[model samples]
Target: MKILFLDQSGKPGGAELCLIDIAKPYRDRALVGLFADGPFKTLLQQNQISVEVLTTQSIQVKKSSSFLQGLKSLRQIIPLIIKVVKRAKGYDLIYANTQKALVIGAIASFFARRPLVYHLHDILSKEHFSQTNRRIAINLANYFASLVIANSQASQTAFVQAGGRANITTVVYNGFEPKIYQTCESDVRQLQQELGLIGKFVIGHFSRLAPWKGQHILIDALAKCPQQVTVILVGDALFGEQDYVQQLHRQVTALGLKNRVNFLGFRADVPQLMAACDLVAHTSTFAEPFGRVIVEAMLCGTPVVATKAGGAMELIEPGINGFLVQPGDFQELAQVITTCLHERHKTATMAHNARKIASQHFDVKIINQQISQLLSSKFN
Candidate 1:
């Protein structure tokens, strides 16, 4: 079936990466319309996916945008909305990959008389979104979307708690290919040597540097851990969070972790970096809709310690496959790291179990099959 997918990101976030997996099966018959152009567009081109930049302008609306800011962005997006509507008429369905995309896709679906599918990637809660934004998202999905595909049970639950239609929403975890994370042993050693982490216990944190992402929390935890522990942050700031990045640097210096922390800003070699790490930490202060890094660490056969909330709770069973710590608790996080450092054999066993479970449960083929069935049963 022909599909038109819409997304509003210019960078590759967890949701954008998930969109790539979802759009791959429909590549031959799909057109991905992006609201802005950047490395994500280049990524689509590299994958041979049909993509076009619908607009060069940025949408000023944010998750915490006030009502006035939302109104202003509405005017800015009118031309883009018209374009999406025109393109939607040629497809069987309009799939929205992000919240801003949903706003335009929902309207386009109504105008073009096509079914709308919204992939809900964020929890619609006060922690992540303003009340105005939450209401707008739920109302739009309820009125215009034919199906709401939530990335986790936490995201779906938040939607329902915010008065969304429970019948229309379903949980679908992000999927990955296990083979992609299996880096060659030589490459992993080279990476570790290049980063000066040869004998150190490397702890990797792979998310954009943001306040809610809890980079500072990891730095705090690092201070309490053994000196052999080192953290390599793999992502850079996006969405005007540069101040937070500066704050993290200051925090690391003030805590005298300057030699132990390495800020390796956005790199293309994620799997290799993950493989070089002895442990991966997901320290988001907020309730993450889905913890992509946690699953990625598992697929890479690296032990993980994630904040115990949102989708993280679903992905990890403490001491079974991986470990969990309470959100924002630096003491608890440090204890988990210390435990993994001391219990080498037990940690390796859990990593083995994590890889096996993640390989089977979150395979991309299985996830795509589920999406296809949902579409066929609902649209066909």
Candidate 2:
């Protein structure tokens, strides 16, 4: 079946990365469209997926107190929407990879006479989005979406609670190409040297540097961790969170963790970095729709400690596969880290169990087949 996949993000986050898996199996018949060009475009090309950059599609759905300003931006986007609607005519279905994608793809679907499948990755609540944004999302989803594919059951529940149709929604976890993410031994050694972590135990925070990601909380936990342990933050700012990023840096310095903390900006080598780290930390201050890093770490045979947020409970078995602490609780996180470090004999066993979990349910091959079956029977 011919499918048109749309994503309005410019940066390559976990959602964008998993989107590569979603489109990979359909590479022969699908068109993967991006709002703008970035590393995600490069990834799609590397996977042999047909990619097109619709430069006029903007990621910034303008959020302002003034309704007039918002209308102005929408007016500016009218020509772009017309272009997308025209392009969607050849597709059998429109797969929206994100919320912004849904906004555009749903409109395109109406114009193109196609079904729109919205891939919902975020929890739509007053806590997660602004009041106006939440209302807009609910109205749009109810009016235009044919199906909603949530990243986790928690996200699915949130969508329905926010007035999204429950019957038309399904939860599909993110999948990983394990082979592509495997790290070479030489690269691990080089990474260790580069981070000055020759003899230190590294705890990695692998996600975008947004305020809700809890980078500052990780630093607080690190302040109480053993001296031999170091925190390695792996990601770049993907939104208007530059002030939060600067605040994190200031807090790290104020807490006297300059030597113990290292910011390794956005790296395409996540699996490699996961291999080099002693432990993975998913320290989001709020609920995450899904913890892709946790699954990726588990697939790489690494143990993780995550906040007991949206999908963390689903991914972590708590003291079996990994640990889960309350979001923003530095003391609890510190205690868990200490327990993990002290119990080195059990780390490998936990990692082994983690891989078993990944293989059983989170493998890309298995997930792609499931998606294809669903699309064929329903969407086709």
- Per candidate, the number of residue pairs that clash is 0, 0
In candidate 2, position 84 carries an lDDT of 79
- Write down the lDDT of every candidate, Cα atoms only: 0.94, 0.83
RMSD of 1: 0.8
> Lowest summed-lDDT stretch of 10 residues in model 1?
67-76
Which structure among the candidates has the greatest lDDT?
Answer: 1
- Mark the regions of model 1 whose C-alpha exceeds 4 Å error after superposition: none
Write the residue-wise lDDT of candidate 2 on 1-380 in tens digits.
89999998666777888888899878999998888888778889998999998864454454332345456567656766787787788888989897667778878888888888888888886668766766677777778887778889889988889888888888888887777656788999998898788899889999889888888888999999999989999987866778888998999999899999998897778888998988999999989888888888988888899999798888889768888999899999999888878988788789889878877888889888878887887875
Model 2 stretches with alpha carbons more than 4 Å out: 57-69
Q: Candidate 2's C-alpha lDDT?
A: 0.83
- Please report how far candidate 2 places residue 353 from its true position, in Å: 0.9
